[model samples]
Target: MESSTRTGFAKRRRSLQGPFLSEDNIDVQSDVYIWNSLLSGYAKSSMFNEALDVFRRLLNCPICVADSYTYPNVIKACGALGIEFHGRMIHGVVVKSGYVCDVVVASSLVGMYAKFNLFGDSRILALSLQNDVVLCKSLINVYFACKDHCSARLVSENNIDVQSDVYIWNSLLSGYAKSSMFNEALEVFRRLLNCPFCVADSYTYPNVIKACGALGREFHGRVIHSVVVKSEHVCDVVVASSLVGMYAKFNLLGDSVQVFDEMPERDVACWNAVMSCFYQSGEAEKALELFDRRF
Candidate 1:
């Protein structure tokens, strides 16, 4: 079986060459794989319109049936092009073909709907999944994007047993922060701290700190400071810069300046954070001083 698979792969690779080798030349048995490869190549190249054109051709082909790989690339193309009408039509295809039960297809559908701000449909599709964590996470993010925090919270609560992956947690936190639900975001952060295995990475802190800054919750920001310090991730430039920005926003100039001073290495964003803080605080002289020093 492995040797046969290798031979098939080698044949596919060879078929990738030459201009006049039409799609018609592909064996009927290999049509799904060939169409998928072509669709994927077109989607990756950002030729979404061309990918849709090929998808339409595939749908019209009498012998071909849309498979799992076919829908994801085409749905992604629809999302990229903001072609919600086409996306709905693809959903119809999925339903009629009984591919709606496929997890990957369902996830792609949820993402496509979400990209167009169609949260109602996205949520319905998400709930239909028997055990789809990825789709649920996508729905959470879409709900957050639509500013429907209640819906996002509901999804998270219901999916608590779904073994929240890092991406899912990040999406929930980011959604709460983006929606200005700083307290809820902080509560989630606190819960994360209790999970011994749930160590925060660089991506986690920045969004949480941004939420603190937006709400001017200086105490929360300070707690995050202590967390960063203890995690030994303070040396990370991204985390340090985010802390500086958060403190600066909350008018904690002393803490902001201290974080900046302690940063062993600084990037353009780090300098910009302090400069923006100085500008916002009406200390034009200090801002200018820092800008001059950096330049």
Candidate 2:
């Protein structure tokens, strides 16, 4: 029975891995644990719709009643999707099922309400729960989203006792980039660079490079390129792609081509980045030649 449950969970997890999963792939015989595992895995992986699909399946299954473990994953998925109405619906279910007291479920609810800018609701829910780093980070993110930068900074500062990690810095960097605060993004990247213990990885390079691209700062971009080389993450496909894009944006087609050429394993995305560079630089013929070669 335990083995079957794990198999069912794996099957559901694999089904939800793609951009579009076929309905036929779902295992109708999956138990509550399997369904809950699917929901949890999918939500954590940012497969929000897939997580919701698992939740709906659980809701319909007579034998698969969602327990406390199930609510947190579904609630987080709802939050990530920014569907406040459905989030509230899930909240009602949580209250009715008496899972509201579960720390995981409560934290997810706080995050969900904060995601929708319903700070009042989030604060009320949060008050009943013990403060944790995850909840604190959620508030920081929500405040940042609401353009309360000062509050965001204050929250992060107040939580200084909680050691910061590269992930938090990356989050701040990406947030700045999204807000078109490229300079600030670079500043955050600089702060991250100065940290002795924290190391920038494949994920870090792309966002910083993206900020450099947006500013058209070739000097900074070159510096980042050197950093990527030093970090030995230059071969990472995402980093390579971002570097190609950064060079392309700066109208340095030659540099973009050089980066693309050096990539040992070129995916369709990397190929497209180089082709796009050529196309955007008024080299349609070259772009076509590359596309033909790719095919």
Candidate 3:
């Protein structure tokens, strides 16, 4: 343990090293609030190895009980460290802990499986949680992650936004676009546009535009481009890069060049996109010119 962790955590580390406790004998023995706080802090701070050490100690403690809150961050650390074996073991713990469907806990489990590239396991875990019931907000991200567009949409019905949480829609859309399910991504974007309160943001458009480009939806891409010009995120470089790539994908290199040339400023990605567009269009001279010229 580091000195910084001692701020709010004094007994946590010591208590975590008690004796080998079995989950099968879960008669609940100790208050693990401080322990959880400690682990959560370590995992969130990108201290993967430290988080695992704490988790191991927590399991060895005869008095402390692991709950739904305990697994997510530790499992996230497993994913971050690419320890698929440890992650899967913790996943079994999650299942046995009866938090498989827990709204607060399920997303991390699903995301961890995705990180493991066990997409099938991710889908199985998600479907088992639903059990033919309507999908909850947390399960939507991994559904699209496994390329199950129908279930993702089924869960993403406008009614699911009872709290009017834009995060639900954003996660749903991002999952689809990120997994290369372009049509589904567009459908989510359409629904997002229809929702009066669930406004899109800078984080939203690049995935949507990437989806459009992948599907060769030139008309839809152009429509989104016009909307980008009017929206507050127009000046966003990532959105700008996506636009440049979208036009290039549409075989409208002229439009791509125009979008690139008009940028008030450019990042390496934006410059690369424009340069690649020129290079792909057989304009090696322009690409070289851009490469040699740096602001």
Please list the C-alpha lDDT of all candidates, in the order they appear.
0.77, 0.75, 0.75
Q: Candidate 3: worst 10 consecutive residues by lDDT?
A: 20-29
Off by over 4 Å in 1: 1-57, 60-62, 72-104, 111-121, 128-136, 146-148, 158-164, 195-197
Residue lDDT tens for model 1, 1-295: 6566545544554355333235555564346876787788677666688789878878876667878888989999999999999999999988898888776787678778878988788777776772566666766765675566766666655454443455666777888877778888887777677755456777788888888888888887888889888989899998999999998888777778789989999999999998888888888899899888887
lDDT of 3 by residue, 182-205 (tens): 887788788788877667888889
Give the number of the best model, judged by TM-score.
1
Q: RMSD to the native, candidate 1?
A: 8.2
Name the candidate that leads on lDDT: 1
Instruction: Write candidate 2's Cα lDDT for 34-77 as tens digits.
Output: 66756766765567888898787678765447888898889888
What TM-score would candidate 3 get against the native? 0.62
- CA RMSD for every model? 8.2, 10.4, 8.1
Candidate 2 local Cα displacement, residue 180, angstroms: 3.1
For every model in order, what is the number of clashing pairs? 0, 0, 0
